[model samples]
Target: MKQSLYIYNNGDLKRKDNTLQFTTYEGDKRDIPIERISDIYILSEMSFNTAFINYISQYGIPLHFFNYYNFYTGSYYPKESLLAGQLLVKQVEHYTCYDERLVIAKEFIKAAADNIYRNLRYYNSRGKDVAECMKEVNSLRKKLDHTEFIEELMGIEGNIRKNYYKAWNTIVNQEIQFEKRVMHPPDNMINSLISFVNSLIYAKTLSEIYHTQLDPTISYLHEQGFRRYSLCLDVSEVFKPLIGDRLIFSLLNKNQITEKSFTKELNFLHLKKEASRLIVTEFEKRMKQTIMHKELGKKVSYQYLIRLEAYKLIKHLIGEKEYEGFRIWW
Candidate 1:
């Protein structure tokens, strides 16, 4: 269980022999143990030398970066250790064949929609009155089979999400009036949480993909483009409802995060430094929480579930097993 290290201050990260060190601008200094770290997230301004990059690459550590507005800019991914040309060809074949691509794409959307429905059901049974929202999403989900092109599939997914977002108003505390999902400097607290948490899931998925033989750029749901890992985006869609959205509803409903926990400047809304750290802490905890997995006949941590999802995709690509998106049963 490797922990992720997050730095929110302006600092210099350097390699100190076999260890890592961070020196803040205020003249404070500290040492970070490299062995316990799996990934490093730099959320503020920072500088590092080539030597530091080489050090992390030696251990295949991922370095994720976020801009001032809390948008995920990019990642310094180490060279692939599990590169397999055989798997890469199979992955590409799935993408190039329209029937194969559409099948995988549909699984992604169906799993996402099912996960969203489970969330609404969970709250509705707990007295949230989310039945109407759930019904709308379910209706759009049935139309998924009628979609032929990727664009049409995406349209159905988008409308499903639109209705799903509406259910948040009933599930969350009254203070959060989530009209719709908005990014590019999220207009409200819920959207801000969505943007930040979704980015974390994406990065975590990318890191998981690195452990496998899959090329992260080749994807089905999202277009494969340079400077981005689109396959992670596809895999993350299935888990966001289980991980990101559930944690958000809990944080708001339980009063762990409130309207006062955010700071808005102009059109940009971001969590306060303390609030941001709190969400990160909670998210890590959620990822580490284990649940009984029927398929494995044992409990698996939420983080490992993401990795498992990747392994399943690889198996599908190689024709070892038929792929099905992970859905919540409990």
Candidate 2:
């Protein structure tokens, strides 16, 4: 399993003949072998030339960039080396056909809703008073099968999220008055953390999709839009509860992250550099953690689960199998 390389220091990245090197402004250097990296995340200001881009492209490693506010900018996706023309056609066909699209879209919502309920249940079991939220989410989840249009499905998902977010106050040990979900400069620490961590999940999903034959732009749950990988958004909905949300809960409950993690002067919108690094460190560890996979009859890392979701989508597209979005069985 190659690791994701995260650059947090202001430096110059250069291609060192089959390897990569980062030189800080303070006159320090560190070398990284190309083979050890699956992808690169640039979280600080960095300068590089076309040669550096060309080198990573040859190895099929993507680069995810973030701005000064710790918000996701975009990704440097290499040209797809595993392109399947027939599969691409099927992907678009599913998106164009409303009935087919609804089937997959509903599955995505169903799995995501199930995972959300599981989170509330887990916390409720731990003595958190989220039982009422759990009831609301469970009630909304039952309506997934009846949703005939994408718009209707999205409405239910929104309501489920609304109820889920309400439970966060009781779930976390910290007394951060988290009300509703907010974006475009998240209003509080919890919202800022959600935006930052969810972006990481989206980037991670994009990297997983790049390895498969599926086109990331053609999606069922989210409308296809220019300059965006909507397929990642669709797939990320299934795993965010299990991966991103749980991680946030743990970080706050254990005091690993708190209000001090953000710059108060920036309206708590800017995550301090050290805090950002700590979040990424814990996130990487979470990705590498493995669980027993009953279907595979062995253990698989959490990161590989995203890749498996892509493979499952491919199977559904190629008529090898019927698509069923991943629901946590454990």
Question: Which candidate tops lDDT?
Answer: 2
lDDT of 1 at 18: 90
Residue 135 alpha-carbon offset, candidate 1, angstroms = 1.3
Which of the numbered candidates is closest to the native, going by highest TM-score? 2
Q: How many backbone clashes does candidate 1 have?
A: 0
Predicted candidate 2 versus true structure: per-residue lDDT over 3-68, tens digit per residue: 999999999999997799999989799999999999999999999999999999999999999999
User: Candidate 2, 206: how far from true, in Å?
Assistant: 0.6
In angstroms, how far off is 186's CA in candidate 2? 0.7
lDDT for each candidate structure: 0.90, 0.93
**Per-residue lDDT of candidate 1, residues 38-82 (tens digit):** 999889999999999999998889999988767799999999989
Worst 10 residues of 1 by lDDT: 262-271
